[model samples]
Target chain A: MTDRSRTPAENAELALLLEVAGTPKPGNVDRHRDLDDLRFEQFLAGSVGSARGLRAAADGAPLGGAFERAVRGMSRQSGGNTQFGCLLLLTPLVSAAAAGDLTREAVRERCRVTTVDDAVAFYRAFEHVDVAVGDPPEGVDALDARRGSDAEPALRERGTTLWDVMELSADPDDGVPDTNAAEWIEGFPRTFDAAEAVLADDGAVLDRAARSFLRQLAAEPDTLVATTHGESVAESVRERAASTLAAVERTGSLDPAEALAEAFVDEGINPGTTADRVAAALFVALERGLAV
Target chain B: MTDRSRTPAENAELALLLEVAGTPKPGNVDRHRDLDDLRFEQFLAGSVGSARGLRAAADGAPLGGAFERAVRGMSRQSGGNTQFGCLLLLTPLVSAAAAGDLTREAVRERCRVTTVDDAVAFYRAFEHVDVAVGDPPEGVDALDARRGSDAEPALRERGTTLWDVMELSADPDDGVPDTNAAEWIEGFPRTFDAAEAVLADDGAVLDRAARSFLRQLAAEPDTLVATTHGESVAESVRERAASTLAAVERTGSLDPAEALAEAFVDEGINPGTTADRVAAALFVALERGLAV
Candidate 1:
């Protein structure tokens, strides 16, 4: 890893670009895969323009307000939901990076400072993209992200901070955590661990990232995969990934992974939530001195 | 193309990013293709960082110094050549964009004002990247770009401006023009024409870019191809591209171009010069409101 210093903006941009550029991630919109209505360039533009506001979130700016502006900037350029998951993951990490501590404790400290206004701003950002979020638990209908401005008064009445809302959705008791909410409630354990994995792997950074992604998917069934495809299908995909990774480990060839990627893409089983984890992991890696 | 107002920096970044993200341009190191040493992420980093310096160049900062700084910034992130050709083509155009007149005459006017110090700085930028420029013309060995700082005094003695050097290298007498120098002396005719073509093409922005690239490569034997492979080989490649384009037009499919791309990538024959021109064209297209 090169020991180059970086501003939070540069780090945020690199994390997002690296996320999209990793090839054969199977089922995901990679460099080679341009989904209809959601091309790769839109993602590139969103990531490039988002660095400033993401950095500001870590530099004492309100996270929700910064996120809203960044999302708006992204929407103006892309007019698509390219990197919504990534922005969800990166905003807090960017804040953690700016705070000069990448620890889970530090990130939790950052998240804890969020206010009802922050929750309102976070919901406002949802106006820009069609993110697939699970329904809020019973009796929280008024706080639905899809409700837009109508949710604001409810959020204000409850005096719920963004952290409180994340706690509501983290679903820790379910054994399979909701990705973004889990990051907030648990102070981003998976993100930090994935970064550790990035540093331990030894190869070209992109190749390492690709390998790490397979490991990530194999280790945890993606939340997005579960959301779109049923839980059984998501589990099956995870098992397939595990087997593919085992073969690569045995033969030291990336060929099997390529085949697995083809199958995943053909079936339209995109594990986008896992890809978001990779993005956050990469940010941690960069902050810890992973070279380009 | 976005109706949204853009600063010169935003325009430059978008153009550079879009240029590299144009997929299946084959043989060029784009989003899908990473050379052993030069990864796609590095190119993204280089382009992201250079926007500021390019904007400075257009904002009445001495063109040479600004260009040198921009190249240096790219090198710092990439640790290798990434967008030297693009920057050379963009410097004048960026200046034109900042001047609020992207017309050929306005661009020429911008070029004309470049000072000898600008020539020195242009030479300084050469230290950062291994740009594929031919040898200097006879009797002007003192103006060699590869000479770095050693060429400075000679440039000073001759009172050469950056525009003057480009004029010598433009080689209007040669029937085949150097893409970079030719743009300088002729006020970017091909670049402008390519932009017009982009606007005229109807499809997704990337598809339009890919089509424009094929057309550009078909129209000219890329100087880079000619330099690496013999002139005969370059001519043969151009002929193949033309026929491929003809087949695509006849069938209304980019499938034929995909086949051509496969052949070129297999042969390690890259028409990089043509790709650079396409980038300039895309910029012009965006500047003129060719929606993505």
Candidate 2:
């Protein structure tokens, strides 16, 4: 409510402007408990689809048919960002975040199911349907309204959450991959070589187990950094390594070994052989220690 | 990320933007997941003066500090419409939506005492130190440097969350209050007449039991509307009611009975006396078969 002179549209615009620019109304603090839970849900729900999904789901029935009519009616008032966020939160993102396992790919693959059914399943599981519509306005009805559109149309933008897919791609949501084959890959072996080469150059920066991790990082930067760096070094490594790779990854062809050589050389971390470079660095560190 | 041509700042920005935004690189995804967890925890773990709550808690300190900072930070972000929204949410303006009970304030309060000492002192129990961390950043490492600060600081501006407090003004974080007294005062038979007067047109629009919830609504319209119209409406009701009450409350001019009578009469719901005014609409709603 900016000034008395504002119009309805101005008032509406003010609401948004105030949103990114307003101050707190300290006098009337709601201070309720479920506040966080409610807000969290609001920021996260909603799904995406297309007229095709709607048509397929409807089998090309008339738009005003009983079910289709309900769908049409609801869609008119159906919240856009709110609904999208809900679908994103309820379906893709939850699986990405809630997967039993801890890998990025697993999280992504699991979240690929961004269908209404996926949302229904998630809500049924996540929200206690037995929950009473006790609060005024009783928003659980929207859950029912949301379910009504299950067989309804969706937007492409709503299909998958950017956040969820990103997470799953890097980390497996659950289940470890078969590293047996992963370790044998020859292309990645070069990274380990480079790591060893760097280590060989500056074992001065190395430690006892640090050599092993460095070797690991070089061998399979994905799993190596994923497991070793945890959140910190892993994130930086991936980003930095990607930058290096991007510079070389041009020409539209991706070769793991080539990517590593380019990234490693670009980073000034020698790219030779994984274990050898690791050994080279650790040997230097150990020798420096021994000399001391 | 911004559709701008390539630059170093853009390059660095893109890496974070892509990792956070999710990209082709596999490891980049992992970083996103870790950062997201931090983003979600931004409010919960945020401290009074601390940048991030998860980092602070992991480093070890009372949970209150981070959340308080989040509250202050979030409050600062919403510049103008705060009062407008607060007024609508407080009064009966947004009577169409409300979600649940357990609010962030309650949880924030929960975090305040998430320590072994506090738990032992009050509940006479103890929890593991990292219990406050909830689930660890799904694929994150504790010692990682990249996790230090991400888009989480920016995510902190999402705006105020008052659903819980609107439903129930007394927050768990503010220490104990005689909520039993508040509850008793709400449930008294003497409230129905006041309820009728407040119901505007009639107890007709509200479910029977919904009338009973009016006093609770008055206490915290924001939370009750969580189930009703969603957050927007919840906020509207609170803002309107608060502004009206604030306008009249300080005068101490009108007799309580007359003031309440006028409020109900204005609503077109007639109540003969203060006591009748409280009971009048509630009885009408119950008689009309509107379920709260």
Kindly report which residue pairs in candidate 1 clash with one another: A58-A95, B1-B291, B1-B292
For all candidates in order, state the fraction of native interface contacts they contain: 0.27, 0.00
Residue lDDT tens for model 2, B67-142: 2221222222112111111111111110110111122233233333333222122111011011111111233232
Could you say which candidate leads in TM-score? 1
Please give the distance, in angstroms, between residue A66's alpha carbon in candidate 2 and its true position after superposition: 24
Clashes of each: 3, 132
State the displacement of the C-alpha of residue B68, model 2, in Å, after optimal TM-score superposition: 23
Q: Report how far residue B271 has shifted in candidate 1, in Å.
A: 2.3
Relative to the true structure, how large is the alpha-carbon lDDT of every model?
0.79, 0.25
Name model 2 segments beyond 4 Å from true: A1-81, A112-292, B1-182, B185-292
